[model samples]
Target: MNMRRNDVNDLQVKVIPSTINPSSAELKCQSSCRLPDRSSFIWYKNGQKIQDETSSTYEGNFSPADSSSCALKGFEHHPAPSVCVHGQSCNRVIYTDRSICASRGSSVDISCTYSSDESITSSFWFSPDRSHQWQNPSQPEDLSKDSQYAGRVQLLETEKGRSTLRISDLRESDSAQYHFTFKTQSFEWRSSLPGTTLTVTALQVQVIPITVHQSHMEAELKCLSSCSPAGRISYVWFKNGQKMMKEETSLYSGQFNPGDNISCALKGHEDYRSPSVYAPKLPSVSVSPSAEIIEGSSVNLTCSSDANPAANYTWYKENEDSPKASGQIFTITDVRPEHSGNYYCEAQNKIGSHNSTLHLIVVTDPGTAITIAAGVTAAVLLLIIILSVFLWMRKKRASNQSSEAEERPDNRERTQPEQDNLHYASVQFSNNQADPLYSNIRSDQLHRHMEEQEVIEYAAVNFNRAGTAPRTRGQETGEDPSALYSTVNKTL
Candidate 1:
């Protein structure tokens, strides 16, 4: 019958030296393939299975000529690659822990254990750039000699088999794999396969809060670090610099007051506490002219609130979704009636927000009414001036007519006759033609009488002897003697 080959291709065993002792070492074994249930491994030395050495690894003192391999217990015919120990006895370096993490701006200690059989000359840590060859071919490189880690790097502890490297003000650029190299009296050795890896990080705080009511009176808070800290972590919470809560967990639940400042930090990192945020207070609004507001007048409004961080202000009017204005002081120039409404101001900060409302009552200016009254008064004065001018012109015209009538030429001629001593009968004529005196005169007789009178006006009359009247024949002709006679009286 043909035998099946065991598929234990990745089974391997190796020896790791301890830094404390150069000659002592520990054996470790692993396999890439999963082993069958209840399966065990066996160890081999120099192509020979040791009797009753059924484990995969063996830890004991061994010479450099010894070679070790591993295989499954049932599949002894198939074995892994043999690993042989190399290098001189006294020229080896080892490290204790190969990884470390530190906070930025803080200090960290990188420590390791090493061993040397020969007299040691020097030892140091370095990061090798494989792409570039060392400038000095004979000397081991040191990171402290580089300009990058000059003052920040220091050797804290150095001894025969142990050393520590301390770096202050750790920066993110400091994150790299570092190796430990040592020079002996005759040989130099560097541990390059596994080096100490460093991680530099910064600490930050994040706060989460939950509110149950409108005013944020009752709430819950959680203080969390930006990165989860290794090992056990404890939290400390503060309110206005007074310690409020200390717990292993990062959560706190309590009621908050207006303007209460809250912050939190990790127990060890108290100097980098979270920024304190205060609860928002109700905002107060005031108008410049506290009395009645008037249209077409200037007005100023101010909003204020108490908060840890100064609040941002926004102004709003009733029935408007967007803000009408923004700032601590809101100004309205030449305020109009439309500006009258329920105005509100919101003051907000990172923690919370609040608002205050004020009713603006814009009234019509009394000066408007005064302007109208002045205009009416001016019109009435103008009308009185026009009426007075009309009345004066009428009186002046009547006086001029009377003066013209008195200065007529006919009146002057009549007065001159009076000065000549002429006797004349005064006649008064009525405007009515129906009177008996005027009606009895015929048109032809009146015209002849006027002609005869004109001729006898200045005729001289002689009286007979004594004052006897002269009779004329005109009396028998039916003409009145008085009508024919002319009387001319002269002063003696």
Candidate 2:
């Protein structure tokens, strides 16, 4: 056993070993100060602290060419000086965390506490998995000096025998097992393999639908990363880019209204949140061929919108009460004038809905327009010609009827002279809007035809026997008082 009374601040400590040789042994401690519990006692070696090793006794071995010391927790500055005890080499390390998980692009702290039984000459951190490819290299290169870690690695010595390797802007390639190395005046510290393992991953948000309804949605969101989470990891959530309060967990279950955007991040790395998921945005519509569409030509309409959940599209015409088609694209087989109008598209999702700008569809008239117009003109001309022919035929028939009446034989016998003096005249009138002859007919035209069914009874002419009267056809035939018959009683 080795003991020393290197009193510092009148606080002395002694280490008692079960064996006096240079090998593993049981040791105990007694302090000159008031003895509290053993857990409050602090152990030291080679004028440096063995962090977290707080016991009145160190129940282990020592290096064959090294030394150790002890003190109370609060009296560490007054530690009892160390004594050389030959047992074995002094090269041991204890990490604050065996494994750590961090998000990519974020910083991380990989810390540890180490002890050596000899005076430390140099200390640095390294990664064995990324070391040089040479066979059995002496030791791995310092991480801070490596080109891959330049300007982003920070080597910190928080205190004697304690170190922290902070890496900024971490990447997946930086993931590996890290170790701490040190050199003494006589020998280099042998590293304990697998010092601290770092796992770098990108944050992602995954949604699983729990319940779906019309007004609202219930879903469970999980913040996921490739790195295996250790222990109780805390998580943070955001809604519409604003921080939201919830219990610390990787999974979140809640009701979301329409148009809500969600994201997540590790509690300590909230700056590196996952991408946001949301409903549809304002939609846009486009027409194929991009020029004027003609009748009978095929045209396609496409609707597009940005959304987390793929949006469904619907096409509708203005002033119409129904939707024309559904899907991202709407096709018209043969475009016609009926298909020409103002149209718009709707992009919808479970969360919300959006509409596109109105577009006017104009189906141009084809080359057949001139032919159709010519056909209509021909039909009108034929109708006019037929009306003119019908009027001519009616006029000829009326003239023939008058001639027959003149040729009809009278039933009563007439004196030969009276028959020669009798002369008769007949006329006919027609009702037609377009006939100029019908418009000029006089009202006293011997019981004119007033309707489709009318009878002209007779026409009688009276002859006066006065001397001063104008001469009639009968007077020219002979000097006698005769009857010029024109007495007609026409009944309708």
Give each model's whole-structure lDDT.
Answer: 0.64, 0.67
TM-scores for the candidates: 0.37, 0.40
Cα lDDT of model 2 by residue, 304-351, tens digit: 999766788989988988999999888987787788778889887655
Misplaced by over 4 Å in model 2 are 1-101, 105-142, 146-199, 210-215, 296-298, 309-350, 357-492
Give candidate 1's whole-model lDDT. 0.64
**Which one is best on lDDT?**
2
The ten-residue window of minimal lDDT in model 2 covers: 429-438
Clash totals for all candidate models:
0, 12
Question: Please, what are the lDDT tens digits per residue for candidate 1 over residues 189-308?
Answer: 543244667777654333344654566565566665344446766777888798865454677767776657887766665665666768558998999987557788899889999875
Candidate 1 colliding pairs: none
Name the lDDT value of residue 210 in candidate 1: 60
Tally clashing residue pairs in candidate 2: 12
